[model samples]
Target chain A: MVTRGTTTATAGTTRTAEERARRVAADVPDPELPMLTIDDLGILREVHVDGSGHVDVDITPTYSGCPALEAIRADVLTRLDEHGMPDATVHVVLSPPWTTDRISADGIEKLRRHGIAPPGPAGGAHGDGRAPVPLALTVRCPRCGSPDTRELARFGSTACKALWVCGDCAEPFDHLKAL
Target chain B: MSGDTTSERSGWRSAAEPSVERVRSGARPGDVSGLVEYTLRLGDDALILSQRLGEWITRAPQLEEDVALANIALDLLGQARSLLTYAGEAEGAGRDEDALAYWRDERDFRNVLLVERPNGDFAETMARQLWFTSYQYELYDRLRASADPTLAAVAAKAVKEVAYHRDHAAQWVLRLGDGTDESRRRMQGGLAAVAPYVDELFDPDGVTGGLGAVAVDPAALREPSERHVDGVLDRAGLERPPEPAHVARGGRRGLHTEVMGYLLAEMQHLHRSHEGASW
Candidate 1:
């Protein structure tokens, strides 16, 4: 049987199921929402290998209806098959739910680099100073180096993003909300 | 032996706590059908609107706006898939997403007429989005507490997405209404065009009435939906059009506008041609 960190017997080194799954998932980028990784989004839930060497991967959807899911599943299967686990099954799970909190810190940084602000902490930050306006706040522009930005819309290209425009650069960017 | 062990453990656990047993026992087959129909209505609304938005993909005035419309459409499609899948399973219909989506005729669809209307222009699209998403957000918020676990789960997830959609439409409504004279005029016209169809969404139907305990009453959703829409229109400096004199219905019973048949034909053509085919 294959282990978590080691490669299979036929391979060079033995790898654990989680490690194998993570390695395979590393290649499956978020299809539509490209800034984040499947791992980063917490969609890559679990990977396991049976005694027969058949691999099973579990994934959850970011949103119930995102069409990119089919493409992601295909990518996962293709990547894993290339990695030597030829018999692989990708299962979709819906329990425990996917939350914005699952987004990794590194993913947030990557999103910022792409010009989209990472979701802010849930229930705005606490400050002793008078309660801040719930709506208006400084959002750094993704395209131009400008803080003079206004929220154009709370919804952006996808449900995951909000629309914001920078007055200085006259560019509109998508802001990824903190789930 | 493993199965026996798991079942024994569950039985012992249930004996120790009667609440779990009560919940299981309370579940009836008819309740499942009710839940299925209720979920189908929600799915139909999302699916139809998503298709309408998809029409704007290449035609949007600006490139960025084009991407924006496609993204919204994707989100709606996602919700539709989940709702339909859940409904299928609950009903024991042996239908999957593809079957529900491509197999159904126009008359079988339960979406509101507003969603299936043609996308006239950017303003018209925004007007529909603003009105529909506002109503959806409110409906899903209340549905979060539905007696059916699956419905509640779908609502809990969709509520967040619809909230963003509502906010997106709200901003555009404000911009167009408060912008130049031309923009304001288009916004007002768009509003007038879509206003007539809003009443049909909240009207009660037989399935909804039968599914009352497990599902949300459409009539109950009307008040909050109206309040939310009115608030947005008021803030946008727009007038609410008078409710239409005669409201159209029958979507739940599969009767739809002429446009629905064309939309369905395009969506289902390939699937019907090659039965059970997959990419």
Candidate 2:
């Protein structure tokens, strides 16, 4: 039996097909929102292998109407196919909607590096200078390490984000909303 | 001992509460016509406005702004789909989202005149967005507590989305109004052209009264909507136009502006031709 939740695959270990497929899929990143991996966004639901060595991946959209879904599907197919999993199917699920709480800690770091702030915690506003915000306070400037940032527009380049301008660095960036 | 155990089981079973079958039923036709009509009206407003916003996809002045407008349009389209689908199911007409969207003629659409207006320029689009989203946000807020559970659910979801839309438009309105002289002039002109249509959004038709308990009275939406609009105007340093005398009417009953037919043709062309095609 494969050890669940183990970060590393042991040397000389015989891994199950499902585990191998998942390890391979770890490389698939979100196409439009490149900062977060599909798994980190909570879009990647499951990865499984069939008797014929085909892979099936389930994904859920953040919102029912996102156009990026089509692009994401195509990207998944391309990535998996190139990884030698030629027969792969990407299934889109609608139940149990995607939420910001699903984003992993590593995903937040990736977003910060990409010039966008990861979503703050579930229901608190950003930087009102209140109690240490539970949902990750301190939106560091993607350009410079400055916490002095203000919202420019609640809607940003995409539906999932809002525009923010760093007062110190004078650069604008996107803040992923805590949906 | 076995006999005693069986007797105890029987006694407990008899004492337990009877199973109640509570089925989730769709909205009834006549009972929810007003509510259905109201939902369709809201859906049409979003659909038409979404189409107008979509035109800016590749044509926006900047690449980022282009993506922004397209994203906003996508959100509106999503809201429209849910609202329209719910409305069709409630109508009990065997209609679905596509049927209602593609099969309906121009006169069948119930959107406000304001949303049907053309997106002339960036200024015009921003003016329209400011007016319409402000109105929609207020409308959704009240509708969240609607008697109909489905309507309430839809409103609760949409309220969060529209809040963002309103904020985005509000920022642009202020920027344009406070910017260069030319920008201010264009903004003023855009606002003037769209202001007359706002009157109809507040006007109540007879359908709202008929669906009394099941509907949000359109008349009731007037005061709060006006207050919201006034707040946006104040922040933008713009004055509200004197309410227009002749309110545009008949959209609820299928009478529509000249542009409706063209819009329908484009929106429905594919579905009408193929009958059933899935992406």
Candidate 3:
């Protein structure tokens, strides 16, 4: 069977299930934004595996109304099961709510390459006696690389995205909204 | 709107009747101090308003508006789901979010009258949204400090969403309210229509009194809520509609407007029809 992670010797064990399980879980693509993996999207919060191979994964949804959260959870489990993991459970945690800034640089590049505009920095600090105020950033066209994009709609097909039209290219695209 | 049914007049009905009884409460068990009641009030507000906003899906004036409104609706629905689920668990009742949402009768709903108000027109929708979200922004901002961790967490997430929504609604109020005379008149009329129902939102009685910091005092929110609305109105060049002589109240105690029945009928019909069905 194909292993999910690099087999590294740890203590007395050849390779730990936790490390393999995490890689398997992280490789599951986001159902909504398929170009990004759960790890890239920063929703996969925690993963743990016991000696017997029972696994627990923690995830957070980018938006409270995000319908893809369940799908994402299922995809994680299904991928784990397919990768030889049997006992696994996904738990959703809401604290320290997901913000767009959590999206990795690779994920941002992936989104740009996929024709969806990545989000700007959500806020400066988290839980620092501040909430995210509306921060207007100049959105550039992912295709033509023009900064003259105008938002066509504040809401898009998904809760965490917005519809925008690039002024220069005249192409409409999905923008991951900064939460 | 003035307390058309003001006197907290024993609005409780026997959950004994009907098809939706499967969505029944455990005879208000474990809810004596009204934490469940408090939680349900917030949840029902989101649920009912979300339902109203969803009606604009295809009918909105513009395609962009349709998406915007629906997105807002979904945000509220998400908040409702969390709050309702929390309420169910706290009440120690078996009811889940769906059961609470799809099973309650009109009188059983603890949502304020403002939300259940008809979606009169695009301008009216904007007006109601501005007032509600302005109030909600302030409420959720303060609610983050709630002693109840779940409520606090829900508020922490929701405060950000409603901030976006509140800004969206305020911009519309400014746009339509300050536009053409025709647009201005309609926006003003919309404000007037929703004015009477605004009072019920800040009613401080019922569940909140005993709940301490776990519950936000509606009284504490009134000043800030109005200040925000008034500031928006000032920028929009729109006059604040005079307070209606009759302020609608009693929703906190479960007495709702006449339209609530129709709204509930539409919302609860499918679930009540297929009692235990799930996809």
TM-score comparison, 1 vs 3, better candidate = 3
Q: What is the lDDT, from 0 to 100, of the residue B246 in candidate 2? A: 66
Q: What's the CA RMSD for each of the models?
A: 7.8, 10.7, 9.3
Candidates' interface RMSDs, in order?
A: 10.3, 14.9, 11.7
Candidate 3: deviation at residue B168, Å?
A: 1.1
Better of 2 and 3 by TM-score: 3
Candidate 2 Cα misplacement greater than 4 A, ranges = A1-61, A68-110, A113-115, A122-138, A142-144, A148-154, A163-173, B1-32, B212-214, B274-279
lDDT of 3: 0.80
**Best model per TM-score:** 3
**DockQ, prediction 1:** 0.19
**Per-prediction TM-score:** 0.78, 0.71, 0.88
- lDDT tens digits, residue span B1-279, model 3: 224221111111111212123224323323344878898999999999999999999999888889989889988998898788767766656677878998877778888989999999999999999989988988888887876656776887788888789888988999998899999999999999999988878888756877887889998889988998999999999999887878888777789888889988988898899986767
DockQ of each: 0.19, 0.11, 0.26
Classify candidate 1 by CAPRI docking class: incorrect
Task: Give interface RMSD (Å), model 2.
Answer: 14.9
Pairs with steric clashes in candidate 3:
B1-B247, B1-B248, B2-B246, B2-B247
Model 2 is docked with a DockQ of 0.11
Displacement of residue A15 (Cα, Å) in model 3 is 9.0
The runs of at least 3 residues in candidate 3 whose Cα sits more than 4 Å from the true structure, single-residue gaps closed, are A1-15, A125-133, B1-32, B276-279
Mind giving the per-residue lDDT tens digits that candidate 2 earns over A1-179?
35643434432232476777776676677877776778877777767676667787766666546767777777888877877778887765432335677788888888888888887776533112121213335776777878898876565767788788899979998888776
Q: Write the per-residue lDDT of candidate 1 for residues A33-74, one digit (tens) a residue.
A: 677779887777767667667776767677666667677888
